[model samples]
Target: MKRTLLAASLALLTGSAFAGTTLDLGYKAHTSSTKDDNGGAYDQPFVKITHFNKADWGTLLAYLKLENPGEIADAQHGKDGKLTVKNLMIIDKQIGDSAYNWWLQNFLVSNRTVMEDNLYLGLTTNRKFDKLFINAGAGLNYSAAHFDPTGASFDGISGGAVVINAIYPMQAFNLKHRLSVNYEGQFARDDEHKSTLGYDSYGHQIITTLKTSLTDTVYTKLHLTHFDSWGSSPNDGIEYGVAIGFNF
Candidate 1:
């Protein structure tokens, strides 16, 4: 009896391992309504690649994404124009059949021109019940922002986020749509120890996207976003974009 039970347990574990490995690659492009704020968003594109494999201890997740952003300049919004690099990873395991989840991510972002880098580590998980899926996670990010305005240099700000997401499927079109929202805030305190230029800033970002299938491997998407900041000198704004995507 004891031998039979042990054999059954091993078989179940082996089967679960084979069920969870997946690989995917995707690309997206966006064009802004006005070329003034940001250069002609004509070829603005982002590419992502991801892989997940079951491991002896847990799951191994790896991903990489790169973006060539157009120049964005507005007197009130500051100046943003640089190539960006982003990397992410996650590893987690199954607790029970219904609650198999992972321990968030190890992520990094870098600005090529300024030589500034930002890093973040966090935990994320998802749960499914019936036809509904719920997911949430949070993490802290640290990075330095240099004020290369010729006379002063300031470097002291931390970023963090809170997220909530859900998805439902409609039987009619055999489509599954997901809705996710995340609130991210950043705070910076002058570390230069200069009182005259000493300043702190806070800001929040919110995003929403809708996705549906157009064919067996084709898909469509719509995105909306809002960002607001408040402090000594602050700016707030909103933006929306829509596009169709293909999977190959």
Candidate 2:
């Protein structure tokens, strides 16, 4: 299933609409516990990658993250650290001369050797404010089955969600700064899977990141997250971290 999804993603990304790419290598710190490999809550170490590009059809956004890198065999990783992969992809296609844009979003998360995936399809609108750009949408969510930490399963058709994401950039003093916000949450749910997700569900998870760079290649980032949950897991907290990396 994973391979098939990846192949399909590659095919969709393959086209003449090639654009620029940015790469960064850095570590993240979480101030609070988050969903982990076993469908439980814990503080984990991670390396994150974010990519954005323009395609003939629309725009593509991909985020790849490796959680609890085995090399850090500490409390976060336990004695035998396990590496996990969490990914998200969004394809935004503008409607023909319409004010709305079609949105297709996919979430793939691998934990305890089991892979969990979800899909969201909806319509969004883009707006600009001086230096900030915003995209907001509403959609339906479908979730696949996955085992929780207790080896129990949670799966089914989750319902309607609304998302609001934005980005802003500016120059302060002698450095360049970029601020971005990502948020998505379900306002409706399917009773059968209302408590499916391991963390931050029913409510929403919002991440706000600010990257300050002295040069084109050197930068520091401050990332903050707010997870408001009203589900089985019940996680409500704020997390802040910093990362230093290169942007090229």
Candidate 3:
């Protein structure tokens, strides 16, 4: 089922990008990592891809990082280690040609892998400065489900916190530079499920990456992710990884 959903999303992305699109494919391997909190026993490295465009409709960006092939096959559905799949999209289409932009965001795997099976529907804006492009959105967040890969799972909701995502690509910073920051907060949720299954009331995750081009078609990415599930101990940590990649 998960595989089917992923396939459908890729199809939608391809369809939407038919006219003006850029596709970059690459393989990344984890080289080093460190953190402030307890790290997971198993690693879930991934191949990350991204796309962004502003059109007559509005603006949108899509990102997907499929877990490493060896890790995914070895995960064994939680027996050996927890598996994680990272993918997200943020689109802000113009409202009747008005200056204000409004649209729905997308669902994504939480950095902690829980309390985040949700989407944001609200206002978005696009801005550019120098060589950087940014598309940001903030709105009422509807958490469609709660998934704790550690065992707990349910349908839940977040009482609307600001979800912000942006990208900064520097094509002439000596070396091509790629940077993006994504943040999602869990300020409030349906009280009925709050604190259930050891879940907490507030949480957030900061995912940042800087990819420096190694050559015309090669690069390295510094992945730094801070995850806090309010007070969840094991899931609250700073995850990091260094990767070498090639453009395809």
- Predicted structure with the largest TM-score when compared to the true one: 2
User: Which residue pairs come into collision in candidate 1?
Assistant: 104-124
RMSD of 3: 7.7
- Per-model clash counts, in order, read 1, 0, 0
lDDT of 2 at 120: 90
Model 3 stretches with alpha carbons more than 4 Å out: 1-41, 72-79, 96-99, 110-116, 129-132, 146-153, 169-173, 230-235, 245-248
Q: Report the lDDT tens digits of candidate 2 across residue range 107-166.
A: 888856345677899998877666667789988887775554545455666777788987
lDDT of 1 by residue, 66-94 (tens): 55444332222344445556676655554
Model 2 bad stretches (over 4 Å): 1-18, 32-39, 71-81, 113-115, 198-201, 230-233
Q: What's model 1's TM-score?
A: 0.54
Candidate 1 residue-wise lDDT at 60: 64
Q: Which candidate would rank higher by TM-score, 1 or 2?
A: 2
Each prediction's Cα lDDT score?
Answer: 0.45, 0.64, 0.56
User: How good is model 2 by TM-score?
Assistant: 0.78
What are the per-residue Cα lDDT tens digits for candidate 3 across 29-141? 22233222333323555566666555667667687765553445333225453345667787777878555688777766644445445677788665555545455556776
Candidate 1 regions exceeding 4 Å error are 1-82, 90-107, 111-118, 122-125, 147-160, 171-176, 185-201, 229-234
